[model samples]
Target chain A: MAAKVDHAQFRLVIPSQTRYLNLVTGLAKRASLVAGLDDATAAKVSIAVDEAVTNVILHAYRGEGEHSVELELRFTEQALEIHIWHTGQGIRSDQLVLPDPKEYIKHPRKGGLGLLLMSRFMDEVQFKADEVSGRNECCLIKKIS
Target chain B: MADLSIAVRHIGDVAVILPAGFINAHTVREFEEALEGQVQQGRYKILLNCKDLNYISSAGLGAIMGLIETVRENDGDILLSNLQENVFAIFDTLGFTQLYRVFPEEDQALAAVAPERKA
Candidate 1:
């Protein structure tokens, strides 16, 4: 029997605070590299993961004290999938609108860029809400060929 | 959380901000304050040297967007230089290159805005 080196999974659970964002991104980058993504793609994956977790901290768990965000990285032969799970407000991907950077800078509002960056860097983004368990999950998938 | 330190140096009328470390949701406040401090002191001409900056998330980008309007309103602009390839890709993907001037070297960025300093 041979060890299945081509497929793996990693999970981390951290406090729902801004301070832990770097840790999540660090693991995302290293895991991406292990999944055979190029350096640039690894960086992009890290950015996408950062955005997703940031949204979870800011929007999902806003004003809620002492919660935890669960992040799982799944590396398959075809793609790298990152799933972020939290118990808070659910997010709808269809509702997101990407701002035009040229015009957006003139008005200068915070937020609305994270989703755009996530969607741009990741090949597929899926959102799921479990009304029964009251949990919301945002999964980011990056295809590796 | 990764540590971020900011040092500012004045070159004529421009204030050059050197940020070393990661700029994510956790560290964006320090970066924002470093930029905001210059504006409060009436130094609107800003230059961000990202030579030592390792990474930035949307939070950091928002901080830049938050301040650009005020800086430009006062007849000054926030310029960037020495971006790592990964950092530049993020800016380019979001079309920041269209709005902000990015130079390969600090001297080039400083020279590009020297005309404004003269006025």
Candidate 2:
């Protein structure tokens, strides 16, 4: 007999609001559980999702016209993948550099930590900007060992 | 999202605030306002009881730092007590443990902010 393998996926479409951070965090938690990740890994995933969604709500939208963010979570036996999409103005990947928290600690700067946290916590982080479709997509992948 | 519930009490010369909830960006403003309100009133000897605070993000920690600066600028200090392990990790990661004095119990925190100790 062969060991059974299963895959699970979940999606959510939420308005670009700070309150939606909880929704994304909850979804990531569930995906981590489905992927059988450890408690620390699950908490890191949730934090990464929170940071990503917060970037969309805070920087992407710029507190202007309303927009919607779509989150997709896919879990397999080997890995967990998160896809976040927003219809706001896209950001340049080059400008998305991760700041060293230590440097900020010495100087005490405001902002710019969210992206850094996401990049640090996620195993792989990718950004795609499609100006034609007005879509900014961020993908995060974490391997389950 | 953690709902922040703040209770402010004057313990002799020190003002002790108990903050209960998740210390995330969504819930940080209330915490900020509570501290700022006290600072503006010239009540700077402050202690925060964080036993009920389950988690804290960088933003939430930043808010605390901002309040620390505000209070210190006015010749006041802020002490934190009963930090959950998760929240303590955040403070440690940011090197805040070096910047602020933290106590394990509420009484110690309150004592740290006593009027006689004000600088």
Candidate 3:
């Protein structure tokens, strides 16, 4: 599927819990198709969505009571983009700690692949945090074929 | 309802786990419990038939990875078979084929274990 003019946009707001992760993924799947992603690309985009949103659910709340994550899915002619936002502890882009390739292969950690998956499958990835608002956002983009 | 369901069948000494449903952070606990239960029963040779698994996240991957050490320490292996494309992509991206053997068919995974079981 190639890029097209105009895009479809969708939004899903869910509580920051593991159970709600699928809700966001469902939106991402729709966005992928709207972006004209083929089966393979759609699968990657969906998985990328799962990873990005899961990070927010697992890390954003930080013990805060009943926080919600807001997800925005934008399907553009050129890309399928997702913005995951939460008003909790934020990830400073400078402090992004990806798994070390050498060590990861030597001994695959029980966990720690979320960031890697997001970065690998998405073409453009950005992380932002606002100290004043305490907003943590992850924007991931997958280019359409 | 949980997003995932795991049904286990004892095939000789191997535990065949049939997981139906997309697996993610919300549902990985069920998968972990099923695998852990096999470990608890001293049955480490695990074969997962993902014929019905529509999706898998890194967390879901972690659930399986978490149990590998225990299974291997007991001289057993984890074999994966019948993966949907979406689920297989995640496993492939993680280089899981190196950690566990993946078969194109469930019977193949079972066949590989049969020799080991008989020996």
Which candidate has the top score in DockQ?
1
Task: Give the per-residue lDDT of model 1 (tens digit) for B1-119.
Answer: 34688889999889999999899988898999999999999999999999999898889999998998899999999999999999999998888898899999998899888866435
Mind giving the per-residue lDDT tens digits that candidate 1 earns over A52-116? 99888888888355999999888898999999999988877776577776677566587788888
Tens-place lDDT per residue, model 2, A1-145, is 9776576677889888776666668678767877888766777788778778777777778754378889988887778999999987677677677766677767765666667766666788888988788788989889998
Docking class of 2: acceptable
Q: Give each candidate's fraction of reference contacts reproduced.
A: 0.76, 0.17, 0.61
What clash pairs does model 2 have?
A: none
Off by over 4 Å in 3: A1-8, A63-65, B116-119
Assess each prediction's global lDDT (C-alpha) against the native. Answer: 0.89, 0.77, 0.82
Candidate 1 — which pairs collide?
A: none
- State every prediction's TM-score relative to the real structure: 0.92, 0.84, 0.91
- How would the candidate models be sorted by lDDT, starting from the highest? 1, 3, 2
- Alpha carbon lDDT at A110, candidate 2: 60
Q: How do the candidates rank by TM-score, highest first? A: 1, 3, 2
Model 2 bad stretches (over 4 Å): A1-7, B115-119
**lDDT measured at residue A49 in model 3 versus the true structure, 0 to 100:** 82
Candidate 3 total steric clashes:
0
Chain A TM-scores for all candidates read: 0.88, 0.86, 0.85
